[model samples]
Target: MKLTLDFYTRPQCNLCDEAYHLLQLFQDDWGFELSVRDISTNDTWTEEYGLRIPVLKYKDLLIDEGQFDLDIIRKRLHDLSSEN
Candidate 1:
């Protein structure tokens, strides 16, 4: 199964940088393709997630704003693994 991390980001956003850095730590371990969507150039994404530069999305679920919990992410990944 391919897990997509829908990263909604703008140019030079510090939080986006930090979030991507954190996500990189587990990229190899998780073994999933990383897709970056620049909301700056995309109107729909920009309008929906304008101020929320860094957002984590998986399937139909969106992680709550201000909630980048690694433990929770780990658990979700583990669950996904078991499902596979």
Candidate 2:
């Protein structure tokens, strides 16, 4: 099955770039899809998630991911798959 992930990112953020890249790699290897949004352009989103770029959302709920990495991504995906 295909899972939907909302990726919040910015243009020049290295961290965001890395997170997006990792997301792409994981999406290719695993069975999922990504929807990226640039929160910097949206005022409300910028205010709420300015510092928290590269946020991932599922089921309209934001994941509390403090740091981004491969193991963390894998774990989150695994955990989410158990919900259904």
Candidate 3:
């Protein structure tokens, strides 16, 4: 099954933009569906990720936040794929 990658972010955020671009670069190769969410649109999301925009999640598991570490996410994805 294809995994879904949830990206929590808000507008006018440089870090978020950079993370988004990075995600897009490997999205196809990573073989996961990217679901981008604007935290500003949801109260709960806003409260949960207001300070941590550009959060990356796979299901309930948080993959990365803030500036986003590619190595961490790559390792996690590799581990997750191995499980299946």
Candidate 4:
């Protein structure tokens, strides 16, 4: 089963841009489907993540937020892959 990575972000966010670039770089290596969600388009999403743009989630599990930590996400992905 391919994992779906949900990226919650909004426009004009520098951190989101950086996180997105990193996610793109990791996409091929991790083999996960990327789903970009513009929080501004959804009220619920905006409310939940208004202060937490650039959030990364694998299913319901949050991988990272804000500036994003590559090492933490990498470890989580490694662990998740091992479980499959």
* Runs with alpha carbons beyond 4 Å of true place in candidate 4: none
Counting clashing residue pairs in each candidate, in order, gives: 0, 0, 0, 0
What ranking of all candidate models by lDDT puts the best one first? 3, 4, 2, 1
Q: Model 3's lDDT to the true fold?
A: 0.91
Point out the worst 10-residue segment of candidate 2 by lDDT.
Answer: 63-72
User: Whole-model Cα lDDT per candidate?
Assistant: 0.74, 0.77, 0.91, 0.90
RMSD of each: 2.0, 1.8, 0.9, 1.0
Per-residue lDDT tens digits of candidate 3, residues 1-84? 768889999999999999999888998888777899999999999999999888999889999999888899999988888887
Candidate 4 TM-score versus the reference:
0.93
TM-score versus the correct structure, for each prediction? 0.80, 0.82, 0.94, 0.93
Q: Stretches of candidate 1 above 4 Å error?
A: 64-67
Please estimate how well model 4 matches the true structure, expressed as its whole-model Cα lDDT: 0.90
CA shift at 23, candidate 3, in angstroms? 0.7
Give me the displacement of residue 63 in model 1, in angstroms: 3.8
Error in Å for residue 50 of model 1: 1.3
Model 2: colliding residue pairs: none
Top model number, lDDT = 3
In model 4, the number of clashes is 0
